[model samples]
Target: MLATTIYEQGDHRWIMFGRDPDKAEGIIDTNQYLVISGEEAILLDPGGIELFAPMLSAVLKYVPADQIRYLFASHQDPDIISSLGLWDQALPNASLYSPWLWEGFIRHFGMERIRYCAIPDEGLNLTVGRIQLQFVPAHYLHSSGNFHVYDPKAKILMSGDVGAALEPGEPPLWVENMSQHSAHMKTFHQRWMPSNEAKDHWLRRVRQLDIDIMAPQHGRLFKQAHVDEFFNWFEQLSVGIALR
Candidate 1:
């Protein structure tokens, strides 16, 4: 697994971990994010159970396990939070912030030690160290109940699967060119994303924010002009083709 610091300023920083070369074949690749502000840190979409060992090992290089006070899951997908049980053991006192609608379902992954702070459908705000993170509602873009993290201070949006891709093998961490990268993302979005109405709402909400970087839970990061390019492309693409 590779760990890269996507952003940093003072004690506030963002680290992205992914591109596991030794990962077992047949499993889809995933990206996990860590946001640290002073003493507290939050892990986002920490990946599946199979990725637990390497993900934990990579995270330890930056912050101690105990310092990870919070865990955020965009939805109840297995690849997104199946490692909940292992994480409960690792961060015994940490709390998980996830969709309230899936509390019952997510608990099946195991939640004896860690507290579950269900995020209401309207979403909510959380403060860690010096930064305030907003859990923005993003329902039906793929899942019945989902949310994405937005950091006003950093001008970054941890956009879950909104801009995800299914690129094969190892790819660069950042998207230097959208023309080449959009193809990898196109099919994934049209198939997995199920609601055009949901997509449009999310686009409007995000456009209001001054985003500098849009980081998804899979593939490369979108920055600067590429971020705008993503918005333009996604706004026009007609998703939920399976239903058609």
Candidate 2:
């Protein structure tokens, strides 16, 4: 997988690893994020078992394995963090930050070597070198215990599955048109994100933040105008409406 630098300023950098032409068939495409702040770095949703090798190699290009002091799992999905065992062996001393509710279940992936930092239902602040990252609650958007990483300094929200879009092939890294992009997102949100209440709650919380980019684990990132457009669209769409 190719690791592309999506955002960088001073000692802070956000690298997205994806758009792999050699990705195995039947395996869903995923986007892994690496956030660097000085010497310390964090890997967000490091990906499934099949992606460990390439993902690690891509990460090592930017920072040494030891520099990756933290691993953030947005939820316990296989695509989200099934590589925990491999990551445990690679970064032996790093800590894994995830929702407290899934600690027991996710531990099955691997937690023997690395420490597991259980985030409360309300979420918490995680400091990596000079950057303070916020773990914002996104409960039941898809997972019963989901959370999103928000970087106040960068105004970027690593939104877990909140804004994910599934495309048949490689798509552009960012949304160029909101109307066109809505097609890629609508069905996924209506089907996978089972609760309108949770969706509305998350939208209200997100609107209060000053976000420049809304990055999801699955598809293209939303930036600037598209960010607001997504919020407006998500707010009105009735999630779980198909069930009735």
What ranges in model 2 sit over 4 Å off?
Answer: none
How does candidate 1 score on lDDT? 0.94
On lDDT, the candidate that comes out on top is: 1
For model 2, give the 10-residue run with minimal summed lDDT.
235-244
**Candidate 2 lDDT, 1-244, residue by residue in tens:** 8778888999899999987777889998899999999999999999999999999988999998899999999899999999999998999999999999999999999778999999999999999989999999999989999999999998899999888999877798999998888899898999889898999899889999999999999889998789988999998898876768
lDDT at 105, model 1: 100
Question: What's model 2's TM-score?
Answer: 0.98
Q: Would you list the C-alpha lDDT of every candidate in the order shown? A: 0.94, 0.92
Model 2, residue 184: what's the lDDT? 91
Candidate 2, position 33, lDDT: 97
For each candidate in turn, the TM-score is 0.98, 0.98
C-alpha RMSD values across all candidates: 0.8, 0.9
